[model samples]
Target: MPAKTKEQKTAACMALAMKRGDLKKTPGTPAGDMAESMTEEQLVELCGSKVKKGG
Candidate 1:
């Protein structure tokens, strides 16, 4: 089996959380977590408005 990347692991964690109803969308907090300020900037810099194959 192929090793799971961090993105893949995070996706699986999110999926499991949703499956168990652990990831709820709080009305007051739009962040819904799933995001970090620094990481978001890094991702944007890396991807740069281009749609990659896997993304």
Candidate 2:
């Protein structure tokens, strides 16, 4: 699925990273909450538009 909003992109990227062992999920925190607070630049820097944009 393509990701539209920053939240969706962040989620997709994070999921991919976790699946690839690039990132680890915290014990008791929602990844969405962390992604929500991230700056757009930071998000882009981390994921680099790897997540496809939705229509």
Question: Using TM-score as the measure, which candidate wins?
Answer: 2
**Root-mean-square deviation of candidate 1:** 10.7
Candidate 1 per-residue lDDT, tens place, 1-55, comes to 2213555444434434443466763333323343322244433333243323452
Model 2 alpha-carbon drift over 4 Å, by segment: 26-55
Identify the runs in model 1 with alpha carbons over 4 angstroms from their true place: 1-3, 25-55
Query: With candidate 1 superimposed using the best TM-score fit, by how many Å does residue 8's alpha carbon deviate from the native?
Result: 0.5
lDDT of 1 at 53: 44
* Worst window of 10 by summed lDDT in candidate 2: 27-36
Provide the overall lDDT of each model, using Cα atoms, as 2-decimal numbers: 0.38, 0.55
RMSD in angstroms, candidate 2?
9.2
Model 2 lDDT per residue over 1-55, tens place:
3345677666646744554457774533445444456554555455666545555
Alpha-carbon error at 24 in model 2, in Å? 1.1
How do all models score by TM-score?
A: 0.36, 0.41
